[model samples]
Target: MANQLSGLDQIFSALADPTRRAIVMRLCAGEASVGELADPFEMALPSFMKHIHVLETSGLVQSEKSGRVRTCRLSPDALVGAEDWFQQQRATWEARLDRFEAYVMKLKKEKEGAAAKRPSRASKRKGAK
Candidate 1:
């Protein structure tokens, strides 16, 4: 569990940067050389490489070196852990909210029941008069 969380943290950290995210997005279509990936950005090659390094380290992107060209691709299962975590969190929150809604409904019903059993102010005033 801890290791999974550690990996998830790394993945999230890698994806935190817009540059890295964009790289991942581009890789989703298909693999591309590092040069091709960096072409759209204004930053220096070294700076762009740093983002690629993070993605590789996080296991989100896989790269191969063929001579001087490095091609990067998105790993199909890279986000599985994060997606599972999100699903579990969503289920837990939905359950809690459902319970809260039930409790509120109970309280509302009790309040209405009490109101039904009570005499109205108008009736009391009429009797007094």
Candidate 2:
């Protein structure tokens, strides 16, 4: 359990940065060399490498050095934990909201039913008159 929490912490912490998130998004399409990945941003290669390092440490990405080129690809399995967590959260919230809606609707119907059972002052006056 501790290991799972630690892994989630690392994944969320690594993804907290915009640059790192963008890098992950780009990698989602397919693998690319470090140069290609860094091309879109105006930062220096070294600066960009810091983001890649974070991603690697988080297990979100895997890179291989071949010749002079370093290529990176998404580690889809790493995202499974995060995805599962999100799906569970979504399901819980959906169930809660559905119950809330039902409660609200029940209250509304009860209110309407009570209102219908009561006679208006005008009707009372007409009957008395």
Q: Best by TM-score, which number? A: 2
> Which regions of candidate 1 fall more than 4 Å away from where they truly are?
none
- Model 2: how far is 53 from its true place, Å? 0.5
- Cα lDDT for residue 18, candidate 2: 91
Give candidate 2 misplaced runs (Cα > 4 Å). Answer: none
Against the hidden reference, what TM-scores do the models get?
A: 0.91, 0.92
* C-alpha lDDT of residue 47 in model 2: 97
**What does each candidate score in C-alpha RMSD?**
1.4, 1.4
